[model samples]
Target: WYSTNLHWLDALRHVALNVTSVVTTTGFALGDYSLWGNFSLMLFFYLGFVGGCSGSTAGGIKIFRFQVAYILLKASLNQLIHPRAVIKQKYNGHRLDEDIVRSILTFSFFFAITICVMALLLSLLGVDWMTALTGAAGTVSGVGPGLGEVIGPSGNYATLPDAAKWILAGGMLLGRLEIITVLVLCMPAFWRH
Candidate 1:
């Protein structure tokens, strides 16, 4: 489902010539996104880290889990509103337990916190705010490019110091692996079990 305007044009233009979609672009849409305004850029950056469906190669937290989290969170809030109400949250026509919901919430929290911490570290390395924010998001999401002048599609990471590069690489690996797997591996309890 992650398709493109070019693909849409190619698929539709042959069938309907009346549609007046005209554009001549040299590079990919990723580059086009990098060229968007700050608000649009930030949104894409968010979605980039909160990726496609589960089992897809695309990185970041999958959509279904986020939905489950939202539903559970809302249901929990509703319980406070009406103490005796019985509300059940369902995903994919199946019921989810408290443990599963808690796990998803914890994962999302850590994922966001990790990005912010990485961005702070990047800022300490003399990277500007936009670059740091988008860079952290892109790295953690495995999206490959950040916003702003240096790290955007028009630029490369070659100019960054070895330390910064290593930090970003670690973020990429952690994000791709999912935060829990790496954290669990780091814990002594995981080894004992």
Candidate 2:
């Protein structure tokens, strides 16, 4: 699924068309999940994290990368406990190299860390923890909006403090461009030999 394959994209598009029909009911309808209490809130959080597939307009960490990371980490752990055993990590029927596995894990970890740090910074700027955290995650993940009373779809970013707005704007840029693309451009090392 990580390949730049057209047929795979077509298959994904077909599935998306089907799922959109079931999950999305009416446009611009933001249900008041708070009425259902904490259960709805938790469910919404989980779904947001599960996210869309790679190459789609949808957000969150892509499925294929998750599969690759999982395989690599598990195999790595197994090797630690059983050095004599041989373990190979595979994705989409292709074996993954150590470098690719390392890169994916690095990206994923830094992505999560960035969200958390941004959220904490926003909170320091006077926003509540949940509002800042989910807002940071939602924007950084390109999932749009987030849970809680503020910055949710039911709410607007217009009222936020200027600093917070700028932070969220940066988060959107980071998400859309993907972290690696942004970091590479910013790095002094990237400019050198």
Which structure among the candidates has the greatest TM-score? 1
How far off is residue 45 in model 1, in Å? 1.7
lDDT of 2 by residue, 32-129 (tens): 34344576557666555555677765666666677787787798899999999977777778888878877878888878888988998899999988
Candidate 1: residue pairs that collide: none
lDDT per residue for candidate 1 within 8-29, as digits (tens), equals 5554542132111101111123
The residue ranges of model 2 lying beyond 4 angstroms of the native Cα positions read 1-29, 76-83
Taking all chains together, the TM-score of candidate 2 against the true structure is 0.78
Which ten residues in a row are the worst by lDDT in model 1? 18-27
Per-candidate clashes come to 0, 0
Residue 142 of model 2 has an lDDT of 68
- The 10-residue segment of model 2 with minimum total lDDT is 21-30
In order, the Cα lDDT scores of the candidates are 0.70, 0.70
